[model samples]
Target: MIKTTFSIKDLENLSGIKAHTIRIWEKRYSLFTPERTDSNIRRYDTNALQRILNVSYLNNNGNKISAIAAMDDCQLEAEVKKHAEKGNTTNHSLQEIKLAMVNFDKNLFNRVFNTGLKELGFQGVFREILIPFLIELGHLWHSNTINVAHEHFISHLIKQKLLSHMEHVDYQPDEQHKELYILFLPQNEMHDLGLLFLNYELLSRGRETLYLGTYMTLEALEHFQNKGKKLVYITYITVDPTIKKVPKFLKQFEKNVNKNGNSDLWILGQMVAKMKDLKLNPTHKTFDSIEQLINGLETSKKLEH
Candidate 1:
């Protein structure tokens, strides 16, 4: 009932299967016969998408397409489930997660996440499974292959997990060699999972952090001015400031920083990556990935010592 019909392009985006390869599979192996629209355009149903996702998962895990094509649906489902429970490795769980998203099965999503959490702990679940899973989900969202419901379903699940982790983090700010980090998003920016997770990471490291999550204006951030020994303003900008508005935000942020407070703005997310040359004199730095940003923080912690 959730409009499960998809085009070949949607299948490609959702499954990471090249259209050409799908065509090849159809011709050579009779993969799944797609129904034709009134105009004879190929349209795939929910079952077809699931099959493609299952096939793609197996194919990515070293199963040959020809071999997969020969297997019956029950056999494929059993094998996929076997891999899903095997270990933290393999694309099986991600494939499962995708299917869960399609079905809007909250229980399935929790099961996959719990398995990773049990095996890897919180950070491990984040780095090993959730982050990579997000990268795939991003591709789906970017390609418009997924709807708002799918995106919101997975994001809120992740958000709940992050919040749960934060509740247990002991907020111990090291007295010596300590910096107060004010984490925020620019005005109109509503994405906060990345920023919240960062706050979690910093808090876990015993760093003092003030998380002003989402939709923070430059004017409001000025209040955190000069809050500690060393001040660092960190933010993940996913939306709100466009490629054009980014430079303007940089200028405004610099002015908004505690005057000569010797603060540095550490920026992350796509806007910075896209606008790599956007500079902030000596007041700002851009990180390409979360790992890079974490490494930078670790190095900063060492230097502060």
Candidate 2:
């Protein structure tokens, strides 16, 4: 069964509106008419959520709450569309992307994504739009606002876009950068979208990278062999490698692949970030975010020059 009703907090989270302000809008502006529960708590339907998002978008774009409240739902949505067409603010684009996901509308998703690319460029779209959208998507998933299918649908679409962009980035191995960056996801870890984008960034910056996508094992690294150049193995552990197993996995990786120190491991994602006591080998490193990892790599490259 689908979750059609949401609490006031969900509305605030999804719309970026304050719960107090939502209450005010309910009492003063009559903007929302959320139904009350048996105990008098408020419950809002999907339409209310969409309307508040639209109102937030319009109000952020200079429309007054009084004026927004006066407009009918059609007018409010029209105003939002008009403003969205004029400019691609991060918030507005995020809302459109969320709606696209909820409705499973490929055309709408493409339209918003393409618009963002045109205005923000690929990196900007990813940093400003897609990243935040994905973060919120996670929240939605945990809140039960969306199911796994929704997550998969949107993830596949984003992956396709990332792959398409990556294909355009042609990089020949630079003699100066002898370090080969190999990106992958650990075994049982299927979330590779972040790693995919990281590969694009690496390739775009002229880093020689081999993307050995999801469900990879440390033993698999042996196949690549040490060709004399340093092999920098990178993986984003969004899931899998449960906290208890991360240390064991790292130790196994050291034993299996990096025993000679010919390779270095760069671990990332929420999993490792939460492991406050994680000890790393002198050659290994941990990054809290993609940006940090990218900056570290770029700095290393410059130092090499």
Candidate 3:
């Protein structure tokens, strides 16, 4: 029931197939019949776009386009299934997810994620599929292989899914337990998928959380601290607070939240790992991955009692 119309550029961008070649395929092989707009401009629907992506994947992997076009849909699907079922590494799946992201194909992304999740489980999918996919996306964006719009589209989709999962968690607060973690990004940091998913994980464990979403100023934490409740201020420093600004940010954050003796700062992301002179305060800690951070929390709690 979903209408999936796409401009010619979207097809080209998503499939990595040249527009001219796509036209040739349309004319020569009768691959897809795209609808024409009022001005006679061609637009593709979701099904057509997905076919092109599948064809593109096949072509990229040494299948001849002419041969691919000659095959029936069932045959083509069989071939694609064989390739997909071959236990391709995480990198290959990441590439497919990136393509789906660019095209804004929720179906494709869901299909890919579900497939990977079935094979890898939630934690495995996070580490093997989602994490590497994000890293690759960042590299592509930084190198100008992908535009900012594509990055934003994909990130928003992922964030939405994480938020949906978070909503299903039943939160319970323990006054005696200093376990409620508030997660956010700094004012200039726009990345929230990492932080959002962390919230899902924490909430899944029956811990309480106050997610401030994204682009939050440090001053905002003061309001929460004023509540006189023990809370952990968790943040992902992917951008905005770069390595040079980390010491200053941490110093200021600690000074402000110091009034709440039970408060601590938990930071993660590439920027945190890259920091060399991270002024270590007793109330601050840096983690390389979400798993490490969560494990550390569990270990800390065990040692507390």
Candidate 4:
């Protein structure tokens, strides 16, 4: 279900403004006039949420709270647009993306995305902007600030961007590349935007990749092993294989997919935190962040040369 009302805490999580500061702004500048329930708890609607996000953006970018509060709705929005266009700062783009996700505004998302693409190019946009946005989106999801629909909506848009950009990549893997990168999501794990980005990264680097998308099982991966090339199996774990089952999953994965040690498993996402104490097999590697994964690959390539 779409969220119609949000609490002050939700605003705090979304806007990166403290609830106390929001309360102060409400009383001092009338920045928001939230409704009060019988229990006196503040409730804000979508319009108010949008305002606070814009206000927060301006405030973070050097506009004073008093100056922001004095502006009318049109003036406030114009200021936001002006500041956003000034540099298309990552924070501004991120705030705009968040607003787009919250309001289900496809046009807004596309505008911000296209602007980033023009200015930063695909790699810069993905690594410098979209990755941070996704990370914050994950936190918002966990904090109960956003619902599943918001995630799916934004993910679909980003997946579209990745696919369209992938189609434009002119690079092709050479016969001497000697490694095949296979990306997938574990069974019951449906989040694939990260995997899609990884595929784009591989393709952009002239690496051969087989993208299996989502809901992949260990048995399905076993088929690609021993193909006379070094197989790099990569997976993004968003919510599958409960923390309790991760050890078993890893064991089964090693036994079924990498039993011959001719392949490697590169694991990423939140699940990696759960495997800290678990003894990984020789062929297993975990990346705490996408930057680390990309950098590690480049570093390894340098070492290999």
The TM-score values for the models, in the order shown, are 0.92, 0.87, 0.69, 0.91
Candidate 4 wrong stretches, greater than 4 Å: 1-4
Runs with alpha carbons beyond 4 Å of true place in candidate 1: 84-90, 302-305
Give a tens-digit lDDT track for model 1, residues 9-122.
Answer: 888987889998898899899998999999998899988988998899888877889899998888888877776666625376677788788778889989888887777788
Task: Report the lDDT tens digits of candidate 4 across residue range 166-224.
Answer: 88998777555789999989899987878888888878777898999889889988988
Clashing pairs in 1: none
Write down the worst ten-residue block by lDDT for model 3: 171-180
Residue 243 accuracy (lDDT) in model 4 = 81
Q: Report clash pairs, candidate 4.
A: none
lDDT score of residue 139 within candidate 1 = 81
lDDT of 4 at 72: 83
**Model 4 residue 271 lDDT score:** 84
lDDT of 2 by residue, 79-189 (tens): 887887777478898998887787677898999899888889998899889988887887888887778987998999999999899888777666787888889898888
Candidate 3 per-residue lDDT, tens place, 1-305, comes to 22357777667755668889999999999998899999999988767766787788778777898999987778877877777777754645665686676566778788877787689866577777887678767766775555777787778777766666566656665444656689888888877777877887787666788889788887767878665566788888887777877888887887765565678888888887687465588878888888898887688778977
